[model samples]
Target: MPPSQELRRKAVNFKKGFKLKLEPEEIRKLEAVVEKATDQFTVEVAEKLRGLRVALNDVANSQIGADQAMQAIRSLSLEIKGMGGMFKYPLLTAFAKSLNDFTKDMGVPTPIQLDIIAAQIDALYVVMGNRIQGSGSKIEMQLLGALEEAARKYRHH
Candidate 1:
């Protein structure tokens, strides 16, 4: 991230779906996304990011057909770029960065990698959501694992 608050102010990424301005209500809503989480609400926060991930996937998988996958990916990329930083999930922000970088070439994904990414995203939502709801599930565990890997792998390049 940029060191200066001014840069943070100026540097919101629309491509990743970070809104340029955060309304107080939206900030409050977002803060509620992690109200139940512990440890600075990181778990709660990542769960909130899962909502974006699912939305991104929906945008990505909007099937005109297989060819439409590229359009969806591009659209999702912009959303990820735009929102990643604004939402304050630095690790999620980094995942968006990694995805934006990896998919820039627009090659096809193997079934396994596609499976991995999609499943992990789903898992993220379940786990993070569970934390807020006072519960846990198998999917949530998997999501946590995926997040751990993502947190480790995503460097702030």
Candidate 2:
């Protein structure tokens, strides 16, 4: 003989869904705030660049804690990559992404690789220092292409 068991099913309660609509004024206000934040992006990125530079210097000099410095470079480059486009600086984003990608799997970089890294860092500085928004000029594009080529050539060598 088998005993019968009762099965209870509970209905899931989902809160009512409402459409999220922002009024024109609210949208304008939000845009204004974003604009202000964008203006502050330079200062924040500059600080990060300084940190990157310090790490690069450490690596270049073969200083103690070079691994930690490499990690810092990777982390800062990633952060810069993430923030650049949000502030209307796609050029900066491109450079940061290049730097981040180059350093992603690197340990202690070779001297030539270090040179490539320095060039990328310098490109980032050029972008930010000139406030070059969007995709930048033809020459900048050429520079980016050259850096990418150099990175690829020296990556596995």
All models: lDDT? 0.49, 0.89
**How do the residues 56-127 of candidate 2 rate in per-residue lDDT, one tens digit apiece?**
999999767889999999999999999998888988999999999999999899889899999999999999
Question: Best by lDDT, which number?
Answer: 2
RMSD in angstroms between candidate 2 and the native structure over all alpha carbons: 6.9
TM for every model, in the order presented, reads 0.38, 0.82
- Separately for all candidates shown, the number of backbone clashes (residues 3 or more apart, or on different chains) is 15, 0
Decoy 1 TM-score against native: 0.38
> What value of lDDT does candidate 2 attain over all alpha carbons?
0.89
